[model samples]
Target: MDWEVHQNPERLVKTFPFANFREALAFAHRVGELAEAKGHHPRLTVEWGRVTVEWWTHSAGGITEKDREMARLTDLLLG
Candidate 1:
């Protein structure tokens, strides 16, 4: 749970480090698949060696239990 909590629009954020751009992009694709399966989406920023994921419920206007669950699943992706 290394996620950062942000207010104003409330969300859970985490940045995962990778060895290279290819690895980072692959991770982002995996996350997209997960989001599609769960019907929940997150903001993903894929960079050269890092991918930042932000999870929030847009309709709810903040973080929710689903967001927390998604964050956990996202962590498991790295493991």
Candidate 2:
């Protein structure tokens, strides 16, 4: 997993579409579980039919491997 692969200007940003808010929230919950398990959390934004996830090591002021790993797992959940 490489955080550099995600090209958002703010950094560590990934977005996905869902059928509805319910699905988006469900996916967010799954992300929450993973974050808790690994002790790494992300900033999440849920809209009508989409979710935007941002992950970065705040203390370090940049993205890290953990963010990429979580992004992959989040993609898996969406799949």
Candidate 3:
């Protein structure tokens, strides 16, 4: 999945590369839509050519199965 697991906060992070800023922004928007529909949100950083997505459960204070499922769904968004 090419996702990195970070400690302390304990989150799943992944960066998706796009051809340009417009594409990256669109991806971020799509991710936002997904988050809203699922009632779960992630931290998204959209740059000129990439979007970084970080998923974690704040209430649980760490990553959870839902976060992993969301990450998998996020990958499917690119495909």
Candidate 4:
């Protein structure tokens, strides 16, 4: 719910900050695991102090309710 949802291409995105690269990478791995479990993958950009996640349904040719839910799950992952 704290994520930024975008239109046009239709996607949900969010950036999570961390203390260091290791922390960011660990979060990214958790996101990866979430994606695998739900079969809904996001574009993950991992950086030293941050990780960005963008969710959209490629099969749907845009964003869908599934993507929104996946975005919600991503939040849960962080929690």
RMSD of each: 0.7, 2.9, 0.7, 1.3
TM-score against native, each model? 0.96, 0.81, 0.96, 0.90
Give the per-residue lDDT digits (tens) of candidate 4, residues 1-79: 6778777677888999999999999999999999999888899999999999999988787888998898888888777
lDDT of each: 0.97, 0.77, 0.96, 0.89
Clashes of 1: 0
Please give the distance, in angstroms, between residue 77's alpha carbon in candidate 1 and its true position after superposition. Answer: 0.5
Clashing pairs in 1: none
CA lDDT, candidate 3, residue 35 = 99
lDDT of 2 by residue, 24-46 (tens): 88888888898998899988998
lDDT of 1 by residue, 1-79 (tens): 7899998799999999999999999999999999999999999999999999999999999999999999999999988
Candidate 3 segments exceeding 4 Å error: none
Kindly provide the TM-score of model 2 when superposed on the true structure, using C-alpha atoms.
0.81
lDDT for 34 (candidate 3): 95
- Residues 4-37, model 3: lDDT tens digits: 9998899999999999999999999999999999
- Models sorted by lDDT, best on top: 1, 3, 4, 2
